[model samples]
Target: MIIEKLLFHTFIILAPVLIQTSLLEHHKWSKSPIFTGVLNGLATLTCLAFTYEFAGLYWDFRYVPLIIAMVYGGRKAGLIVLAFMLIGRTIMGGDILFHGLASAVIASLIPYYFSKGFWKMSPVKRVVAAQFIGLWPIAIIFLMLFVFHLPSQFLSELHSITFILQFGLVQVLGIGIAARLNEWMVEKKVMREEIIKSEKLNTLGELAASIAHEVRNPLTVVKGFLQLMKRQSKGEEDEYLAIILSELGRAEEIINDYLNFAKPQFEKVERVHIKEILSEVSILLNAYAVKECFFGEPPGG
Candidate 1:
């Protein structure tokens, strides 16, 4: 009979896990906190409907779903699912109804705390922590059974170590499976985000390289004219023409850097002259004086 009960609970516990994993793979519901909560709540209710009975006492892997909801789904999801489980258990009206409610609360709280640092732990540690938190409710239920002695058969099973061990084993297996599934889902999400970010960067790099190439040709023509103007200018105007030529050269260097995205290995390795670069950059506003004279309406007009 104990073996039969174990087998029954095992199926009940594992079925929801499989369903949850499938939903995670195929649906966008996991991205929304409210939807995730609703999904978990429904799963808990379904598991509760198939409660395992032994020695006139009933229990289910309901808490396993609740724990998963809280730990992976966040506080709002946990609370929402807990409320659903409470309502369902209230309707069920069994000898252990209140005991089950209390156990659910404990189960939810345990994982809530564990989740604060859950991702920091190694995979093995995560599984161990999940199993421990999952089995804690069972221990709580046992204590309630012992202290209340309402079931009458509670005392009979109170000293049965085999019963406790079997239940613990079931909790460990159920919670471990759920935890691993949650970890896998998290890993897949992170990998997907990374891929998306990499694609965006690649697209931006290509766009930048294209824009830089287009701008460089016009800039080169402008620099050639400025150089010719510098050669023709006299003393006072010579200084001004030199500034314009240097500023145009700096602009070309900037465009060249942008183009380097297309062929980074061919980047210029020569040391840049910091003073010359700074002088060109500093005189950029003065270069605008020449630009205004060139493009703006004549001074007399």
Candidate 2:
């Protein structure tokens, strides 16, 4: 735990440098690495103290690492968050000494809940979940802190209320932006896949049309000869000649079905009885029907 806290502090010091180098390479920054690291460390430590001293101030800082790690990295980022949390608590001498640590623990656990449900969420929804999880527990902490002490000269009830509201608004906006970025990436990937698939389908449709045209001419010639043979026969022709022609017609219908499948078609839907359609199909296939479809008990039963 002690080692983890040290690593958390180290991450806070270096995270900006790591982020700027890895993600912000194309973007310009006026800050230097050493300066940025020191500033981030100081600022993070200050916020940790404030959150420890005040009940709900932790709301301002909860999801920073979680969002960064989850978006850019993965579960390892959660460890960074947990490490920072423990370090922040230990530095302030734990919640017991601070009088508000108990509240902070509940407040801090919100992000973990978000992480647990991360896989189930869409990009936009994941951001919303992180935002809500980060801020909702702050209300409980605020109530705990507020009720314990009366407002002093500098801190009034109105001031605390305004701060809470503003804090929440900022959180929502930040998470919203991050979530939008994630969703944009997802949309881009989907569009790329659709374009590739459309190209492949277009090529296939052209090839099928060419093949169908070539086959249809030979099929027609064969049908013509069969018809001539029927007309010239004196004795009763083969009994199955009619069946052969019928099967040929069915084959042509199947080819038509395939052609239609290759080309897109739109249907205008009207309300109709699905059960009635099924019964009609069954009637047409009576000779081939092997089993009856039942809604309930069998007729004999």
Best by TM-score: 1
lDDT of 1 at 57: 56
- TM-score, every prediction: 0.75, 0.49
The residue-by-residue lDDT of candidate 1 on 1-301, one tens digit each, is: 6657666766655554566567556577655667767877887787678777655556666777677777677778778889999999899987777777777777677777776777688877877787877877787767765766555665466556577677778777878877787777777778988999999998988888888898999999988887888888878998888888889899999888767747657556788899999989879868888898899998779
- The lDDT for every candidate, in the order shown, is 0.75, 0.54
**lDDT score of residue 220 within candidate 1:** 95
Q: Give the lDDT of residue 8 in candidate 2.
A: 44
List where candidate 1 sits over 4 angstroms from the true fold.
Answer: 1-11, 14-17, 23-26, 113-126, 148-159, 264-301
Residue 9, model 2, lDDT: 39
Worst 10 residues of 1 by lDDT: 150-159
lDDT of 1: 0.75
- Each candidate structure's count of clashing pairs: 0, 1
For residue 226, model 1's alpha carbon misses the true position, in angstroms, by 0.8
